[model samples]
Target: MGTSINDHVDRRTFLKYGGAASISAIFAGCTDNQSTDETTNESGTDSPDSTESDGGSTSNGDDEATEFNYVTTVTPSSIDPMKGSDNLETLLLHNVYDPLLYYTDGTPPELQSWLATNYSVSDDGQTYTFELRSDATFHNGDQVTASDVKYSVQRMMDMQNGFSWMWEGVLSPENVEVVDEKTVRMTTNDVYAPFLYTLPFLYIVNQDQVEANANSDGQFGEHGDYGTEWLEANDAGSGPYQLASRERKREIVLEKNDDWWREFPHGQDGYEVVSAEMVQESATAAGRMREGAEMADQWLPLQTYNDLANEDGVRVHAKATFNPFYVYMHTQREPLDDVHVRRAISYAFDYDAALTDVMSGDSDHLQGPLPGAMWSHTDDLETYGQDLEQAQAELEQSEYTASDIDLEYTYVSGLTVEQNMGLLLQSNIQELGGSLSVNKAPWSNITEMTTSKESTPDMLAVYLSFSYADPDTFLYPAWHSNSHGSWTSASWYQNDEVDDLLTEARRTVSQEDRVPIYEQAQRIIAEDAPALFVMNQATRNALSTDVQGFKDNGITGYRQTFHRYYQG
Candidate 1:
């Protein structure tokens, strides 16, 4: 039986890469169905087409009454679902595309059928058969078929980019068989435990639409880049909305799909357009909010959130998330390579101060990689709190004295909160008789430096959320030797014992049996101190008071469907 959605298991207690405080008065004086005349874009440009009096356009009794403006810091690398990697890209793809299995925020959280109406798993747990919904159709008015599923999977494998790692050892082109027009069968190489959880990422694209837009000189033969070039600005899905226009890092506009298969969840009185403006600067986002500009309806950072809390017509909603922030201590480096030194650095830093002062109490101190929400999370693990004495003692045991070594602490530039946290760490490390230099760089530079161990700094602060809900998603990618050199596992810490344990746990079919193995692995990694377990972020967003039906789910965080929200 699937877990009940209402199971409030408080196993332990956390942003994507983001900070906080209280203002209960923010929600006061909120009026229903308030309409704004003009909507401001993130670049401080006025969207002339967005001046509809009803907040959205309507045609022939079509119930298009609202237009929700959402602001984000990140930009989509690509509109193609298979190529999406970051939160912004995934957010756009989720609304524009439909996966076979849709993840829902139901009590006991479950995978709800989307394109596929029903599915069956073989007794061996290796074969999965799915029956597509007959009524489902792509945005271009093409009927969805089993062949489309096969084509999509084959295309993803052929491209070998983005989420290709999902099917690495589990599935191949030969395993995806179209039994009939509406039925498809998928066979895996092994008993993959997270197969169902990973399905939501496999968005089914229209085979015909993609082929029609293929370029002759594209990367893929015949398929011609698999319509990637065309998909960069267009969408090929049958979701609630369709792409109208995209300005790369500036803004993306999605218009309501009037011929959508499923009715709007909240009925006909929903938004007809969703505008996602990219506001990279938190200060700019805050300024827009303070001025009561209709630039964004939802999704703002803690810095902007705090600034808007006291402002009238703004409502602040915060929810604990599974994403955890960490300070990766590169084990390949000189002083950080020593376990004692890593432990000393972990103990010396003040976790509470970082969460309270730096983060503004918008997060919880996390002891390990796994968040408290996961079933395999072990709460008994030692949480290395602030202890200067223990830190000094651990440093004394290291081969090199603190005074003899200088360390570089790197953080993503433009993030004021992260800069503050880095400075705090520098101060903490300085007290241990070491000279620490704080380096600020763009997120792209940090990602580039992590590609090689030689370029990786002594300590790197990063905010990472799980791609899937499984423990392997957290452990293997962040700790396994295979993940070394990747930004996710910048520490370059490798242990044969940990690798074996993670392998065993992943291969184990029974969740009950896998718990102990994962628990053991967690303990081993925690003791190694390759990364400082900082905190699990609490996603804090400031929404306009008139916004309604916006429920924050821990798993999806801010990447929610605009259809779920409506102007009150």
Candidate 2:
């Protein structure tokens, strides 16, 4: 055993060269679901018809009284799984991919084993071993093994080739152990309470595909470069779906793993997937969802959220995913370096006012790092508000007068949600005392600003998903100095107290006991105002009325197959 305790859409390092960008290209883009006589003879099944759904549909429950299979897709900026950072990974990707263990359908720690039939840890918490599901098979029809598990995770631990740092300090390569081809073990340098929750997101890609481009000269194929060349643009998951195609912003397709051996929805019985596909960031994904062109869908962003929230025909399913929106002052830089000035700015604008007047009250005011959905959420915590007198007084306390306090904010454009947010903030600051400028840049440019050391903007609005539901979601990665260790720590905040609070929280096992500590940590980060922790909104989703059986599925696992699909 080693040590213990570690842990989305998040990263876009892989740059695919070409692909189609139309919604119509869907279904047609799904290339190979055919059971050729060769493999079909081995597996003993006829070719699954792409046009007809397994016409044998059923209403599994009250919510399932409709006609269709499950319809969901993980929407990561990239599906490599190792670089996962956004709603896509936690909400969707894990469904199609498997790690050692995962949250059983409705229970938090039912810890139903997937690729791994069972797992165990040493008494010292130094090492962990997982027994692979002997019957498991990858999308490529390859056997699942311990090497694939070690290779996939270790690659993330190797930073030069992978941004394993995104896992923060939870994963340490010094701890991984391979116990033969069927058993794998992991040891941690420290105790980690959220270990199981973190594993589901670490999808196991096939070792062979990872080494597809290895140099014939013998130096490039090994897992040693730390997964550098292997996972660049590969897929090896043994789940309900497999990578059918990926054409950068065009479309990504996942033909169902007909050989998938998992039990049916709710584990009642077993079933085979006919086919499943995920539309990419291309213009098509949105079009299909907006036009109601299909029964299955994935990755609907702001527009989809708004449309379905109000539309009558679409059955929108939205839960506030783990993301916190915020605005920050660059303390390491100019004017913002002064606390009084920062406080003055904080007081200058009223967030409640902004949410009401602009956000249509869809969002809430800033307080703690965790959202209302988190167990630690506390309206009782100290919060910021607009105070003309206090704001002016703070401004007066600082060297800058009204005219001297000139500030600029950078934001990503092309979204009404974004426009209203920035404009409201601009108005808030303008009414208080300082002169404020808002710059709306493209998503690419805005992302660049945060990652660069020399060019990080003085002030900007960023929405980050706290991937897992644990308090560490807000603590470790958001506040720890080590969090800033990676280029993604755009806030550049340094607080020892905050870091300690998070570290302590992660070490403890009781979630109930973890609340007070997290609450106090929230108070600390709020006062520091690394980013004015803004509001949390329900990440929205919608299904046609015919779509059922998925209504009550909380923020855990996603089953887009025939869990409750049937004819209404």
Top-TM-score candidate index: 1
Backbone clashes in model 1, listed as residue pairs? 4-107, 4-108, 5-107, 5-108, 6-107, 14-536, 14-537, 14-538, 15-537, 33-568
After superposition, which runs of candidate 1 have C-alpha atoms over 4 Å from their true positions? Answer: 1-65, 214-224, 290-303, 360-362, 396-405, 442-458, 482-486, 557-559
Write one digit per residue (lDDT tens) for candidate 1, span 1-568: 2222221221111224443222121222322322222133333221221333332333314544467777665555567888775566667888888888765543224456778877887878788888888988999999999999999899988986556666766788789999999999999888877787777778889999998988878877877789889998888898878999988778899998877776565544567777887777767777765655344423343445555666788766655566677889889879888999999988999888887676655567887877777778998999899999999999899998988658888976555556677888889988888878988876556666887889987889877646665777778878877666567788998899998887777678888999999999999999999998887765556677776655543344333567555556
* lDDT at position 405, candidate 1: 59
Give model 2's TM-score versus the native structure: 0.74
Every candidate's lDDT? 0.71, 0.54
Candidate 2 local lDDT, residue 398 = 78
What local lDDT score does residue 106 receive in model 2, on the 0 to 100 scale? 30
Model 1: weakest 10-residue lDDT segment is: 5-14
Tens-digit per-residue lDDT, 240-304, candidate 2: 65555554433445444556656434221222232233443324444554565334343343444
Worst-scoring 10-residue span by lDDT in model 2: 11-20
Best by lDDT: 1
